[model samples]
Target: MSKIEKLLKKLCNPAYKQNVRKEELESILNHFFEGQWTFGEISGSHNYRIYHPYFKNFPEKFGPEGFLTIPVSGGKFIKHFYIKILCRFINEIKEIEK
Candidate 1:
């Protein structure tokens, strides 16, 4: 797995099963996805572009909702799984803030 994937999985794993405070989860989401804003460059950054795609391929393959409701059937399956978990974490954070 790539470094970015490893870190994302690590972050999302806690959010998925643990009871993290809303503030920390927001910090994690913003820092990892929005703050860094590059893919495969920074150690903990994901291409923010992944969530807002201008092109069709990302959405077509992963779905347009920015979260994987169903499984992604391909290589790098674990990374995609973490991405879904991350999206869910982000949503949960938003819900809590509201």
Candidate 2:
């Protein structure tokens, strides 16, 4: 397996399961963006735009409402949490691309 895939598996291990906290998510994001410059660079122009939509009901895949549903906990937490997950997903995709 690729380095990114291995990193993702380690980050999303069953030990943590779906109970990933804000701190853990932040750490994941930090690691993912350690060398990356921008979200567009990490996820590609098309996917970066799709992942960051202003409208909620634009589409199921465009938003994080589908992939992550970890009990609402204020707007800040929700925003950062989804951002981290998106970064993780994009990193995984980059691994596949390699």
Candidate 3:
């Protein structure tokens, strides 16, 4: 498994679920997708829209169809579950390549 796979595996693990640093998740995402963060329609929410054409059909086309719920801890931390949707897509892409 690749490093991303490993990390995603860890992130997606139910038993290991924990709050993640928002910036850390974004850094990992920046490595795989082209996107930027914007405030979401939901109050205190944010969305990371993927612009990379190759990723348009990601995660069985669930691609970029969600928003990140508000971060916790003064807005520096986010629940991994909220962003699990994002990682699922990124992982699906990685899995398909293999």
Candidate 4:
């Protein structure tokens, strides 16, 4: 697999997730999707969300409301939760790109 894919796979695991920072994952989403997606806060820095065109391709179980929660108050460790969410998101982006 490619380096990005490998990294995302590692990040998918709970053990390696805590090492990720919000800025790093946010950068990946921003850079990977570029103009095709939108990023914004639902309520300033206290809450956030990401929207992408490829979300339409997601499976029914993933939900059609089409939003991912970004936690902002649980310290750095909480970012680990986000890693799992975004890793799935990035994986979807990868498949869509292919």
Q: What is the C-alpha RMSD of each candidate to the true structure, in Å?
A: 15.0, 9.6, 4.9, 3.8
TM-score of each: 0.29, 0.34, 0.55, 0.58
Give the best candidate by lDDT: 4
Model 4 TM-score is 0.58
How many clashing pairs per prediction, in order? 0, 0, 0, 0
How far residue 46's Cα lies from its native spot in candidate 1, in Å, is 24
- Across 1-98, the per-residue lDDT of candidate 2 in tens digits comes to 76655655665553533434455444544554453322234432312222222224434644554222333244223234444556456656567558
Cα lDDT of model 4 by residue, 12-84, tens digit? 8767746565565655656665554343444345445556766656637335856555665444434667677
Each prediction's Cα lDDT score?
Answer: 0.43, 0.43, 0.60, 0.60
Q: Is candidate 2 or candidate 4 better by TM-score?
A: 4
Q: Output the lDDT of residue 4, model 2.
A: 52
Candidate 4 lDDT (Cα, 0 to 1): 0.60
Best by TM-score: 4
| Candidate 3 structure quality by residue, lDDT tens digits, 45-80 | 555444444454544553465333334454677676
- Please give, for residues 16-66, the per-residue lDDT of candidate 1 as tens digits: 543333344334546545742223344543333334332224565556654
